[model samples]
Target: MAARPVSGAGAIRVGIGGWTFEPWRGTFYPDKWPHKRELEYASRQLTAIEVNGTYYSGFKPETFAGWAKVAPDDFVFALKASRFCTNRKVLADAGESIARFTGQGIVELGDKLGPILWQFMATKKFDAVDFAAFLKLLPASQDGVRLRHAVQVRHESFAVPEFVALCRDAGVAIVYAQSDDYPAIADISGDLVYARLETAVEDEPAGYSPVELDRWADAARVWAAGGQPDGLASVSDPAPVMPRDTFVFMISGAKVRNPAAAQALIARL
Candidate 1:
């Protein structure tokens, strides 16, 4: 099962946060499926995956290469940047931590590597100067592999037009988080759109209802075709009409049904 590519527009990738989850074992995966083969199976089902483990731990080049070999050629892995790089008071001083995280064999993923997500703490406030400096620290490429960066700011202070402008200037995507606790910024600030849909419920078999899934599918297409959706909150006007790759991940909420939600959205697309 290779990833399905959309024609005429930028690719719209649908996926879950990560492949490994105990709850997914009979729900999303086969009852007798081997635990070690979960990535191989999940990669075939979803077009992309948000790798959360990299946020907490570092892996060897071989570990990353091994993952690349298992997944489909068109399948991509969006890695969460290390907490050490974004969890500090002075974000401008995190160049060393950022370098360390980027240099940690991530280029081994090669073309399979998607965007690197830099998620800030909920308590962190928006600082224009510091944030701008921090964004400038991100490398344009690593070992010949071009890298895409997206920031997930949890605080409401980041909901302003200034923040959107900063990300636009830096060419880094602003993650549109659909969590009640996080500020949802729908403004298009980068070349790509990264969305984390967190409003899933255990009552629904697919985490989200069919109507919601349909809505998301429509939104994904709009984003891929370079236009903002009508309903989401946006601090700025719609971005210019141009194709942009879109990454939509079913995350948080009823975590158990996320895989189903991702698959459902993929099916709709």
Candidate 2:
């Protein structure tokens, strides 16, 4: 469970959506292992974790500090921005909510903080002007610690070139979601790559076939090196080649097998 070494210019981290799950009690965690130490065990097995709970509830500064203390030095926690920020009827008016969420002592995570994911509902359509305004609300740093942001748009309207241009101009990553339900935008808009792989199957021991795992591993390398992988859908031209840190999380589809899937992908990397 030691930190996995990275050899390239940009690091590629693979992980699951969150650390806590009742199904993982025996399958992922050692049988009868202390429930309180789940994050400690999970942090060592994977390089990152997308904190889904933060999307619904806020945590105290001490809670964030506690997480940072338990996690490994190289481990990262990608926070899902609160629902109040992205689920509003008018995204332009979310400044107060955004401020509230960012000001909630997230900086306590320190180096353990990764990207903040702003996810919109599928019903939310793309409004170039309004969306641009929302992106502007995202701060470059919080409490002297630099912050990275990524947006996950589920509507197909977001797959247009203008959307990609907006994110590119703001330097916010457009999460490359690999799923049949969401529009997969593979364009690289920022210096970092954030991906959520949602195609895991319950039948597969690793949640994905070995072939699929290999494919994702290859794609991760390509993304880390700042090159587009072959066959992914894109609305914009290829981005200039430059190294970028990559974060890939196994989420949704077969939730039970996600930890295994994340570990498998990490091994392949």
Candidate 3:
């Protein structure tokens, strides 16, 4: 629950989910303006954050670098691949876009780019054949690339052994989400974990709820205490999972109320 860097022998493996703005609003001023102050605040405790805005366009490299400069050498940043890539399922074109993000956006952030998250929508179901084909298309397979690769699926239909095997075989970390599709949590297990919180109740999807963020933060803590080579059952079991070193990303900013979501999770921590 402490806002500190969660490190292991390999990657720094920390949360890149930065959805809040106020706490960092003044932190990063007119000087570094949004860059230095932002990173300085983030690096104060949290190790990494998900680049939520990159999914949209108009990203600049210099800004990323300013953030990298502020953060310490060991600090890490998880860069989310654009929606054109993950949401649209344009794996082929996604490669080029991803390359651009890495070469441009990431380079600016420098060494802070910790992992590359390929998050998909819940409306998208799992087509094992299509997905398997898509996974094979990543320009550089998980092994070939230096960055960690993780996938988040919204539909429970995708929670099949074949899919899990495919992700495991591909070295992709499958997400264990806390939405209505909540799949036993035992079903999804891998080296890395990406967790998102959506807490907007004023108005939202048919059954959307923002209050769940509190429960999730508690659950994330339980799941983030272990490392890899850790079997599915072991990671799923609450016994070991309770106090494991697993890295559950604190992703937010899915909407305007994301600030509310971030505050909720941060409060729990």
Candidate 4:
């Protein structure tokens, strides 16, 4: 099928972090296929989605292929860069695993491959040596020019200004998160701003609610109107990470609201 023309030229392309769970919230198919109807509904409603489930590893290619076939061409996939890559729990060589993981569902998404998320474990404390070593390994080979690589550090120490600057200089975005534990990285550079609002309620982690979607959409509007570095070059023509676009993601909370949260975001976007 031919790719469809995206309407409303200036509207932001919003996304949910992954999975839509309305159809099978409490009971999901473990062995067989998951919530196909729910996912299809989400795809039609939202511009894109980030596949957070793939972080577990061992996701089948056929499964990914099926999803690709269903979602629209304008749709995108921003995947969490696997536990083996981000989690301090998994100390195994991430360099090799990243290559393998992306080789499957991630890189194969071709143009569909969106942002590669690197969310550090919340409990892991900062170690300058470890952080620098990890940074060194990133730039060498993460993805092609089409993909946006981002890092989401969730730690008290990562709240430091220096660490945030380091990430900026490294050409990696310091993800702005809404959490009580850590202060967000101050926006010093305009390269690209990656903001994640985990819950609809300001003080809760209940995923994206209707009220949350309204606020989120307003933010996306602001983001598109105010072009950043990648969004604007030479101070004349303006663009987004994608031509004439802005990237905003509202994901589900830790309470498995990912699917539901995505559903809410898709409707507003």
lDDT of 1 by residue, 110-149 (tens): 8899999999999999999999999999999988889999
Write one digit per residue (lDDT tens) for candidate 3, span 1-269.
23432443223234445534654354322333555355565565555567677767646767777777777766666777777777665444455655665555565654556556777886877788778766665544232335667777777677567777777667566655444444423443445555543323436431135455545554555455443232232222222232333344543334444433444455555
Badly placed stretches (over 4 Å) of model 3 are 1-16, 19-36, 89-93, 139-145, 180-190, 197-245, 252-269
In candidate 1, how many Å is residue 79 off? Answer: 0.2
Could you tell me the C-alpha RMSD of candidate 4 in Å?
6.8
TM-score ranking, high to low: 1, 2, 4, 3
**Model 1 vs. true fold: TM:** 0.97
Please provide TM-scores, in order, for all candidate models, with all chains considered together: 0.97, 0.97, 0.64, 0.69
- What do the candidate models score in CA lDDT, each in turn? 0.92, 0.91, 0.54, 0.57
- Count: clashes, candidate 3: 18
Clashes of each: 0, 0, 18, 2
lDDT of 3 at 94: 59
TM-score of 4: 0.69
The residue pairs found clashing in candidate 1 are: none
TM-score-best of 1 and 3: 1
Write candidate 4's Cα lDDT for 1-269 as tens digits.
11122443334556566655543355332334456566765676667776788778757777767777778777776777778877764333566766676666455566666667777877877776667656656643434534456777766676555665556556665565655565554342234556665544434333655665677656555544543333211212222233234556665345354444545554555
Candidates 2 and 3 compared by TM-score, better number? 2
lDDT of 4: 0.57
Q: CA lDDT of 84 in candidate 3?
A: 72
* Each prediction's RMSD to truth: 1.3, 1.5, 6.6, 6.8
